[model samples]
Target: MGRSWQGRGRGRDMEYDKGGDNIGGASLKKIETEKGVIARFVIGRSANKGDSMDKSIDAENSQTDDFIILDNVVEAPEEASKKVKLFFAYAADRWDAQFYAKANDNIYVNMDALGSTLAAHLGKPRAYIGCMKSGEVFSEPNQKWYEPEWWKFGDKKAYFRHAYGEMYVITNALARFVSINRRVGSKKMGFQERTPLMVAAMYGSFGVLTYIISTGRSDVNRVSSDEKVTAHHCAVSACFVSIVEVIKILLDASTL
Candidate 1:
């Protein structure tokens, strides 16, 4: 495992307290394996802005010499054998190019600290799955807006139930079949429309849980939308299934 420190801003100097804790310094730790590496970073309050910690940890793996960061954000159908850097961003800020430029010297942030924090949550003999949820803003159809329903009995219940069941089945089956991975996603939607960020944040947890359960070695059904069936976002069911499959492959390879 490799460790590093990172922080936010240019002018602020990180100060260590009597407990030897840096106010802004965030610590990073990378778990290296022959198949891939999972790098997690710990950040203090100063660095917890948006999804900053998440992006930074992803950057470590994406920025590495051996791995290839996909140009397309759209999920792909086929799985690749290349090593992956699964980043868990605990901080609230979005990690942009500017953050990467100052990754090496920010004293207030210790990346290792962040990694340790996550490790505690992950527990020993760690396993996980990667389930992703599109932000509510992106999922919203402008023309199809309606007031939130208290009881979605007719079509909504059926839809949510199916989604929930599928998710449960996939996660549970994958966990039973595989080993040593993480899974995550959001099971519910937030009430507020403007605060779509909360919904997006849920995806991280969902993805971790999905990954842990799938473990990169499970049978996944292809997503499709027919006349009788409709997905949350028109044609995203297949995309979701495919992503789970990809994680399954990655986890399987890692175990090998």
Candidate 2:
């Protein structure tokens, strides 16, 4: 609860937009005791990534100076691993902080509960808390989640699972680890068997579908292996989240 911020990869500063705790209509029980923060509040400014430091959004807590920010960054978990490395590489200004936590939007964190959990590992300099998940990687070429330099694990099932809606926490030390030391690998181009628009329509990945369509890369009219099956066909076939929205997006993309 100090200054808010925005940031991207390492060596850049971030600035957070202050809209109070409630965003849109979804609000969380306002947190009082503070140790960690919502990762979504973190953001970046400035085109120049040099000096790696910039400005901070004025959060509620004026007395304490804990939170920091960054520069230009993609959406979460895209360059997320790099964000971790950047935070760690950064030295605290004016004060000493024992821990740095990562939390973001779509969460209602009990700061008291989180504080107690973090207290147990207070003295340990390099302590890690929360769940660390793998096998979260997918090699969708034109998709945003694809990381070309995935050298953390051997082959498939290497990248940490990325759920855009899923909110979790992590410590400063661990986030800097593999993100900094991992090697880079050659990205092999492969043919996509199915259309993203079709797949997104079939499954209820509203965000992914919207992004793909916005890029104008998805061929909504393109048929699948069956040649007769189009994205519209898939949208109608699946009774998942309202097909109306998916169809609307497909139709809109068609006009573009």
Candidate 3:
């Protein structure tokens, strides 16, 4: 069986039936159907910037219908999309919702306003309602969001008009779609970042690091491109549960 998703704004919810994966772009008629990705508006922490990030900080950070908070998600990003993916699974499984969103632990949402916003989309099938953003496909190796398979595309700037990640709604239809075809989205985007494996090891995000290792996309012993350190060295430098779990996992993977 095939899976399908709907897009809000100007796009239509194209129905699929075990036929093809739509990865965006006209030349690539099929893209992988990602599962467990429903829809969410999230709270985020402000972090470093990629040079391509737009400079209109004032317009982006302002409160609007798209943001569940006072800032656009792209500006104040959330924790990794993995965490939000899990949130989508849990919320969709346990409750019946027209749309779902995620906020930081410290943020509060107005239920009344959210309910009203969702009301407009009740009839929209598989509707994902969020402020859509089209970002550059980072292709350079060892950089953040570097799509290892960038050569598949004719041009990065061209595909920007197609599929994007930041959707913010989920209905029964969307949840069922996720249940059927969900898997990890980015195969290697963060795997070779400013040394993400090392960052995860040092920051005590053992869970994130473990997933990276499990993918067979990372080399535990390889030194980072940016920090010039191995995962083991970063694990040793960290002070927390990471010193135990991260180190052991790294050692085990290194031997394997």
Go through the candidates in order and give each one's C-alpha lDDT: 0.24, 0.29, 0.31
TM-score of each: 0.21, 0.36, 0.35
RMSD of each: 19.3, 18.2, 22.3
Off by over 4 Å in 1: 1-67, 71-110, 126-154, 157-256
Query: Deviation in angstroms for 83 in model 2?
Result: 2.9
**Which candidate wins on lDDT?**
3
lDDT of 1 at 183: 31
Give the per-residue lDDT of model 2 (tens digit) for 53-92.
3322323112222223454443243354444334333322
Best by TM-score: 2
Better of 1 and 2 by TM-score: 2
Which residue pairs in candidate 3 have backbone atoms (N, alpha carbon, C) closer than 3 angstroms, thus clashing? Answer: 2-18, 21-30, 21-31, 22-31, 23-30, 23-31, 35-182
Candidate 3, residues 1-256, lDDT tens digits: the string is 1112222122222322222422113211221222212121223223444332222222332421111221222322233443344345444555455454433221112223334444544555454433223456667898876777677756653233321232233444655555344454421221111111100000111111100111111112212222332343234334323323432343234321
Number of backbone-clashing residue pairs for each candidate, in the order shown: 61, 25, 7
TM-score, prediction 3: 0.35
Cα lDDT for residue 160, model 3? 37
lDDT value, residue 8 of candidate 1: 19
